[model samples]
Target: MADKSNKFDEKLPFEAAIDKAGYGLYSYIMTALAGVAIISFVCIVFASTIIVPTSACELGTTGSQQGLLAAGPVVGSLLGGILWGYQADNRGRRKMLLVSLCGGTIFNLVASISVNWIMLMIFQFIAALFASGLYSMSMSLLSESVPMAKRNLVVLLVSSIFLLSQGIMAALAIPIIPLPFSFHLPALGIYWNSWRTLLVVYSSPSIITIIWLYFMQESPKFMLVKGHEEEALKILRVIHRINHFRSKEEFEVLGLQQEAGQEAALTSSVKEQVAPLFKMPLLKYTIIMTALFVINQVGAFLVWLPTIADQFVRIMQTGENSDLNMCQIINTESPVDDSVTPCSLNETSLLIVLGVGAMQSIFNFIISIVVNQVGRRNIVMMVTALCGVSGILVNLIPSALGSAVVFGVLTLGVVVVGLYTAITVSLFPTQLRALAIALAMTGGRIGSFASIQILNLMLVNSCDAGFYLFSSLFAASAIVASFLPDDRRGKVAALAKEETHKNELAIKTGND
Candidate 1:
């Protein structure tokens, strides 16, 4: 259909043509759309952080059970990350994303109506199984779709969608949870309160996201690599036409084209595609990225920061113990009062939690704006170092501001994840990109799983030691970040070019 522009693809690869198409309204629109999907997924993961404990009172959940509720989504992600990653690489990112987001939202609604704790847990697990795919696949689609020059800041901002969701959740929860409303269904023997209502309120965006993706095209570069040259060029023109409305008449790319001899390797068996990530320098890249993710996830300051907001305030107000540590302040029991009704809010505690989330979200947006100038590696190192110092000060200085610094530093982990995602997306070919990210991010998942267990063991019995452990890990990760090449300026794109060239050569030689 893109007859006039088909020759553009023949003469110049889709990747290069896309670079020529450059950043425009269409690119930003897709960025916003993809960011929304990420927001939905992150909302599901974290919304439970608030909803679980709130429901625990009526649900008769023990502290351990509450922990499980918080971790349920992570467990689901651990199980599905690799599977979804592999699917996106083989099946098409847009298709996998639709399946993930739509499917997750339906089950999240089911979870809201869950009659029992086990039922809710099971529902959440199922929801995460689908939702988890969106995070990894969204990165693939956005990084590949956007131009190289804009990707670092773009991916950083997009990855920060989770932080943004936290802020939104906090802002929305205040009014919604305070509504003082409840809905009960006798047939199902269920009673719903403001907390449960919050789930549907927050998660409803996934429906909008699904509808958006329904009209959105797959990554044009992705289509080109898989032999859908016509479709790819068509998408490129649509993009150009959107961004270049006044000059639409001048849009004359002929069609999608691979480099010379690239057409032969358009198709690949799953194994042929997956095998490369495990071999060569790609393996090294995957390992380092995974480690960084692990550190970020293990020390998920943002998640635990809210839990400790009240505690941090308490310590700061009293200045009681010079020896007190972060885990002592943060990793504590549930805020539930058995004397009160289930799923009910403790006004002060709830507000504090919400406020912390809102503040963190705002900080994330500020970081995204500044990261373009500061450079990602510097941000990672600077934050990790500050986190370590905050860990020490939280122990030594028992001040309110000290606790705030720790909270703010924890937020940096989100930035590191964003930077890693942006860089890694550039380093791999499209065929293996999803799986590669999934595998790398799986490190963070595993780290989260371990961190929870470790914190549980150490936070209460040995606070100072726990504080040192987390802070030291961040310190170590900072050193690691120092070694990671800063690819904010076309480094990933350069790697992608080489990989594309490699893919073309393999296809031309019939090696696949």
Candidate 2:
């Protein structure tokens, strides 16, 4: 029944097969799904910034306790990122994503009913443990689903969605958090207020994401690498049929070319799978990505953007100290007396947060357009260097509006995160991609935690010194970005060549 005279008799590489499948409705839908997954994670992590100040009175939380509550998700992610990555590599991307999303959503729902700050923190922490690896898993699956040419653009589009998530959160929180409704449950000794309602709203995205993922197929490239040739082919055929509006049989890729030793990775232990990244050529990439992550994660300052914006707005409204810098304005803030003060959300601050997210989202979209022409390495260097200069200018300007604009530029570090992630996907093999990304992000989270702590100390002790320190980190990141591969294609080709050599050596030894 086979067409013996068909011109495409030879097997093709997976990337080539993806090209033949073409990009159409399917790629767009998948990229959107990936963006939703990102939103599910982003909303949960950032919801804390809003929840902390709003819930402080009802939860009876002290300053230190509120700090712990704010940090709960970060700590949880720190513990769980590598574990989920390991499972994703050994099992499958789709499975781990489903498992994590479901678990995270369930815990998030439970957290909404929490009566105490400790209860809320613990539940959210557990939720974050489940959600920590969603970003990397989503990126890896998206990377494998599309053709090589569309990979960077689609990945950055999803990153744009990530930036947009902040605005979405602020928009949702604005109306929901200010509602003058409360249901008191005397039996449970708790009040179901706006903050609790906001938590429920935040969990909605994850619930929808889980359902969307259920209809999605496992990565065909993942199956091909694991030696499921028939399964992979079936998925590819469906893709071709949907994208090309042609018969599945017409897809010319008869078989997929698997990377050498990829199937062997199926049986390898986690330690065995991870060891190679530290040994030879991968060592340089691993080290460089870690350094980039450390510096990039300094964007964690955005976590306090709402708080700073609140103080800035208050100062401007009072027409007090009009010529003071950001540090001076922040120092003038009065501490909230949780025991006596009414919990109120600031509208101007929420609007500022929304503006920041919208601006960054636009910037990310612009970056996606230029990335192909400008190159990933170049963009990373250019953006970081520019943001570093902005970081210094943030403290130098005496006007609040000027400083705010510079602060926005400083947050462009978020754009670098997306670029670095796209690079990680191409830099590593399919078998190890998830784990490698997880490791790099874990480093980033560690950096984020340290920077937040150090920034808090510096902001209180020496505000100018704090800004200078982060500016230096951004500068250091730009220097390291210069070392990235001139072209990701060359790097991937070299990795493929190495894998082919290993495969040949294995075959020769078997024959001997």
Candidate 3:
């Protein structure tokens, strides 16, 4: 048979073939593209946090309305997460990402021209509905494309970009939102101001991501698992050629092995794609990861960090020397008029946000460097527990500077997001990986939406309670993270075990 002829040369396991592909420029480019995808998704979701405040005068947004606007992306992403995950597993990661990015960008552009806060919220929700695919799928594509050795570091680095995006938005806002230019549109009955202009600028990453991803290859692992071995081999050859700067013919990976127990036929139904994650071996990881996501994503402290910073600055501006805990400082009546007027962001608050983002990004990068050595499980436990302690400390800190520092530490929960993602990639099988992440993210989005809404109420009535609640959540997360399987070696052993099980089943079937 032609298959026998194809096997004339030595073949490699999937990981071996990935190693043979070599690490080089192509790998760096894939990592960069994945980072851009993170920037796009993070900016799109959080853009309203900045825009709602800056545009308060023009949009006539109340505090409650602003909270709802902030929740829109979470709600939309929550709704779309499972659907996008199902499609990504079924349809292919690259193709679905292109569709989602293009669609999200178009809707995001439409959001810029909105006449009112409600319209803006609606459009942003729709945009997030499309953009939701980027969350898990981007990680899926990047993890599958790169060699396994670089996988954890590269993924964490990209997650650092997610943290950096807040600063990116702040840096972008520093120049753009303060621009003293406005144009009135008589027909639409709204003023075209810097905030609206900023939304347009925010959409640029998705545009750039779409263009880059269009030229890139589908995850070869996905291809291989789906029984397109020839196509997968071709991609590996291209990777080898580009990585080594050598001819494709010199790449001697003549064949690739299917992952142990990989389903050759694509699962056509949503149930088929999702069911595996809830059964037997994968179920425990799903439960733990989802719980961790829910706990970490209770974003009350983080969502309100900027507002607290701005409030702290305002309080200090009044020459009040009395040291106060977070609740006291935030709840203290400021001497200045708090009314929405001609829009402006405090330079100090902007700096605080930028600083927090910068610190987190650097920390994430450092984690990327040492993660392979320290191990993902150990890192997750330490960082998450640190976040819990910080959250508790944030409420106790009386000094403005101290509170800001602790808030930065509290926000370290963002780092855990990346670790959980890396864990999920290693924990789940290729066929179910995207869907499993999507399901976990669905839990996270719900947590975010609930946390934001709950915090809105708590920050008004009981600020300390909100901090205590989130700290408790983080404490719980750290406890759960301790149980994770050693990701690196576990993945290899799991594959070999599955292969042995399959062989035994075949032998038993043959005896019958």
Candidate 4:
């Protein structure tokens, strides 16, 4: 018996590498880096909904223009998700993440100084094109780097960046955008306003990303999948050194298993690669995850709370808010009056909304903490069900605070979306992992875009009907969550191997 464990090692080299490296300091470094990238991306994401339209008002654009501007990043993300996703699958995860973040920051800065609506949209579109890939790629990179035991919680840790980013943007915007600052240049055909300065401030995360790449390393598992066994081993040992606080420990595992005939071609066309995800077991998983993305629009509605809560205020308390809704208020066809800017908020209201966002962040963190104990599927279904019921409670209840409380509960549904991302990423192997996440998020990006356009139309008439519609969607998501396969227990790699073996057999039989 030369080596008995060699056969077991051959079958699951990736798992073996993970076993050797384990989870400690290396995992913490990767998790923190991924969280920062997510925070940077999310900083732009939150800005698009809140700050972009406010910028539109600052520039005196129309409702149609506002809708188009808002959709710019979502569309960029739609394309970037797929394009960068396929690239990450082939080129390497870490490289694509660095490229996307760097490029996104550059264009974000350019968009801040755009002369007109067209320039703003174009620059922002290009920014989105480069930046959106970080979303799915960072998730895969983080997942592959961490141990199986801590995967779900790690994903949540990265996702909590959204809440942190939102608060940071809000805190910055409250002070920056409200300034009586103005710089007009007729020669440049640009009238720079406080909103522009504030956007540049929000885009500061670009610098953060550049610094992150300095300390990070490429994922060893990705190297293994790409047929670099020696390089893979080298990286794993380095991770082991950092994690175990030692320099000279041998990793017993040789390498991750490579598919038969995989050396014949390093990569395939995007379609051939992505097709497997749409077939059999993987197909069902993709659909269920996409449904989660579609139903998570409750977070978007909550963004309108300031406008909604403003309706309950008496004229004596806060001047004429105009009987107009959020869409009408922000999307004025004429020049935005100097007297009332979007950021013209009383200190009381500003503090209250920030408090609400902080509260939602706390609940999301709680979900992450309990995810390991409660199970991923159980957590999503339970939270989304309550989110659905909260829709009804919002209507039955009275007072601005009552509706506000219900909407805050509904925001918890967004956290469930993060758990869904963690669950979805766990299902695919490295070859299809990033692409699967991108595909599922494509549905989400589409939903976000369509919802904004639809809400701009719906929020005008029956705001009550809007809440009911969102409620029904969340309820439907809970039903879909019921059908998703729970793969937390050593199933993803095994399933991928089985699927591959079945394909090879089918090919052999056809040739025979």
Highest lDDT scorer: 2
In the range 1-512, model 3's lDDT, one tens digit per residue, is 57755644566777788887888878888889999998898678778777877878888888899899889987888898988888888789999999999888998899999998899999999889988879799999999888877888789988999888888888787778767688989988877888889999999999999999988889888889888899999998788788888544466677887655565335335554555566655667789999989988535565665666677777888877457777788788766555523556766777777887899899999988877667788888888888888888886876866876777777877888888898888777777789889999898888889999988888889888888887878877778988876544445457435633543243233223
Cα lDDT of model 1 by residue, 1-512, tens digit? 56645534346656567777777788888889878988888777667766765677668887677667777887887788999998887778999999998779988988988888898888898898888888889888888787767776678777666556665666667666656566788988877787778889867879889999998878877787677878887887788777766664444566555655434435656666666665665666777788888876434444544445545554544545434545555544444345545454444555666565555556667767877567677777887777666665555655445555664555445556776786677666666678889988777887886676566556567766766777778768888877766644445446456755664454344434
lDDT of 4 by residue, 1-512 (tens): 45746533444556656877878888898888787787778666556655555665556778677777777877788878888888898999988888888888888888888877778888888888888888788889889887766787888877776655555566666777667667887877776777788778867776787687667878777787778978877887778888888555655665567654334225556556766677665677778888888767876565554444333332214444344433333333333335755544433444555666677677778888777557678788888899888875765664445555676676667777678788776666567778878888888888888876776567666656777887788877878888865443355456446755654343233223
TM-score of every candidate: 0.87, 0.93, 0.92, 0.86
State the local distance difference test value for candidate 2: 0.81
Off by over 4 Å in 3: 1-9, 246-249, 264-268, 335-341, 487-512
Q: Give the TM-score of candidate 1.
A: 0.87
TM-score of 3: 0.92
Q: How close is candidate 4 to the true structure, as a TM-score?
A: 0.86
> Which rank order by TM-score, best down to worst?
2, 3, 1, 4
| Shift in Å, residue 112, candidate 1 | 1.0
Off by over 4 Å in 2: 1-10, 246-249, 334-341, 488-512
Worst 10 residues of 3 by lDDT: 503-512
Error of 2 at 183 (Å): 1.2
lDDT of each: 0.70, 0.81, 0.80, 0.70
Model 4 regions more than 4 Å off: 1-12, 246-250, 259-265, 302-353, 487-512
